[model samples]
Target: MTVGRVGKEILEEADFNKFRQALIEELVRKISRGGCYGADIRQIIEETLREEEFVNFANKLAKIIEKRTNISKESSNEAACQLVEEEIADDIKGILHGQLEERKGKSKKEKEIDFMGRESKLWDETTKRFIGKKHGLKDIALILKEHRLMKITIVTGFILLIISAFLFNSIYKAIVVGLTLTIFSGDSLRIKLANVLGGLGGILIFFTSISILLQYALLEERRSMELKEMARDYLEKAKRKENFN
Candidate 1:
């Protein structure tokens, strides 16, 4: 979608309007309170803008834009940031500058320098939080647990264990290992050793199956992460290309 189209949609969003108004009102209240230095005022403004509700609104906007335009989330997020900077930040900076002027009556040169510095800082923080933030990767274990291949591997492994138990007659050995070592107390040393080795071999087969499955799961998860990063990078490049055009 064109930048103007996205901007128009952002302007029409009710939540965006509410967020913008609330931000301005909060900033005005905080700035009007006496005794805040310029830095303190900037900090207050930045902290307020970064509040959970405001950040959530930005995220929500980005998701909506992504869904509507079929744009990459990163590009949609940039669009969201642009909307916020244009619709909310300019008004905030204007109010702040006016407040500073009233409070200090500073020379124009001094006021201009301070204003530029604060503006730079605010934008830097906003850009970092809004556009540069990343979503956390899905939990590999949880994801793999529900994976079709992983489930098959687990069931197959269990079946192999049962088959091994029957083939090697290691069920008693397994019971001995699981419940009590004293099950074969009256047996000869050779018998005990044979049972132990047979049981261990069966267990090893099951564990080897599990290990292979885990390795496959990890590789799949890593590949998924790489694909996501590549997509984000592609989107970022596309955004840059769009801007250049």
Candidate 2:
């Protein structure tokens, strides 16, 4: 999926992230050149930390500083880590702010140029309103026509379904449904109705087959139980006769 343009430059997902990181690194390097310890730098860092976008960059920069300087991630060095984080964050914010301001200035200039070439029409407002009203009426007519077609399609599908269920076997019903769908499937409304009716028919057939199989299974189970009980009774009567003899 393509991400929309940021200013005049279009950026994909990967490129956007890379751009953000590069901007942050470049800003940090620029500030570091001016000597990393100053009141303005501290203020910038504090402001950058407040912005949500720079939080991850701040953390990563702090870790890099610790690694390079061999500082332990202990309570004693926590303040130092925070200072480093703030310094990087401040630079990133400054660079981003400058870029945003520059884009705004360019956008304003482009808009002014565009406006200069446009002619002012005295009756433009009335013309636009009339055109809009005409389009709206056309849209309403189209919507009504779509609804009427859908209703007709639904009625036809239902009639076919009822006829297939009563006059034919399951295979014939399936074939009828397929033929009816093929006949009416050109329009969007007809296609949707066909799909819905076909799905419902399939579900009903599945359940009907399952119910028949379940009934057969239950009947067989009952017959087996009855035979076992009869055998047990016969054995009891035979033993009684033997005892009596």
Candidate 3:
């Protein structure tokens, strides 16, 4: 079988860790054999590149290529074989580099001056934008606006509360009698059953209101925590950028 086919077979298992382990094994073999494993290694990388549609794995593959080539250079070889192996290693490295460059979307720079002063413009935009005293309030407002579920739940709870009030008001006597039937003292079985049902309905409505209020409280807490997390992330990024400068 061709080296590419061999690589395809190795990668057929489709586990990244497995592929990495197998690549390491191949690298060790290549080092021991003074770069005889060059084609097989290159083909393995090619297969990986083909399998991964996105370029997320490009950087990792680049690192692997670096280690593989470094080991190939250190391996012992006869004078004639050393020259041939070195050439093969160089070719492999060059191909890998080219593949990486293509994936990165880099191209030759255009011959143009900074006539628009874009760098200065960007600096001004970044520096001039102030986080005001009310920025925290503004961020909270933004979060509330963005959260549809929280708003919907609160509104639904309010509507249900209103409905419960209307229901209770319409049948107040029934609900009251249902609670204290012994006090009324002239109750038939059918009347008692109706009163009991009316009271249960009122109780269910009140419980539903309580449930909704609890839900709102939980959602509010979650949103507050989320805001803190966002602030922390922003601060971290700013700190890193400051350190980098």
Candidate 4:
């Protein structure tokens, strides 16, 4: 209730639109400041209204405030802004509810700037910096990171290819597979689809490379067996020489 707006269902139920639509500006003030029983709210109301608007704002609030206490007059701008703050709360809820009803699928974040009491400039700068970074790749490291996320998932696959080669010792296969998979990276939909197809091709390339590596490993295994046999023959000859001695 203090932060969120009242939904359309409650606003319609309360019939506030039917009764208070004509008194929009006045209602907005009362709802914003949160009507209090003290002079604080009254002072804010008095300060906010002009000579002409005062008559209506006061007259309108008098009827509403009189429900609990007699309407108090405000003498300063500060008092008026505060009073308006309270007045706008209910009206804000009503307006928000109407918007929600109209836009059934979307929700909005509420932003209020209390310029009188806060440093708005600093916050504005920070927000701008954050938004800027999100929309574009500003720095080298970030660009590299972004490109890595492209449809081909270039960064991850490049890493994967490097790892496969280092362990398996096939530079050519690594280069081929890395290139095949890294083709799909871009900040676009069509590129993402292309990346998928490219990845399938890369997978085929990967399997072929694995097959080649397996054959190499088998050749190495056969060469190892031949070396073991030669070593055994030398050891047997050395054994015969020791037995004769």
Candidate 2 Cα misplacement greater than 4 A, ranges? 1-160, 163-184, 188-191
lDDT tens digits, residue span 197-244, model 2: 554554454444455456444544543344334434444554587699
TM-score on alpha carbons, each prediction: 0.30, 0.27, 0.29, 0.21
| lDDT accuracy of residue 122 in candidate 2 | 7
Alpha-carbon runs more than 4 Å astray in model 4: 1-197, 241-245
**Worst lDDT 10-window in candidate 2:** 123-132
Error of 1 at 193 (Å): 7.6
**Which scores higher on lDDT, 2 or 3?**
2
Clashes of each: 0, 0, 0, 25
Clashing pairs in 1: none
Candidate 2 global lDDT: 0.37
User: Candidate 4, residue 243: CA error in Å?
Assistant: 4.1
Q: Which candidate is the best by lDDT?
A: 1
In terms of TM-score, the best-performing candidate is: 1
Over the full model, what C-alpha lDDT does candidate 4 score relative to the true structure? Answer: 0.37
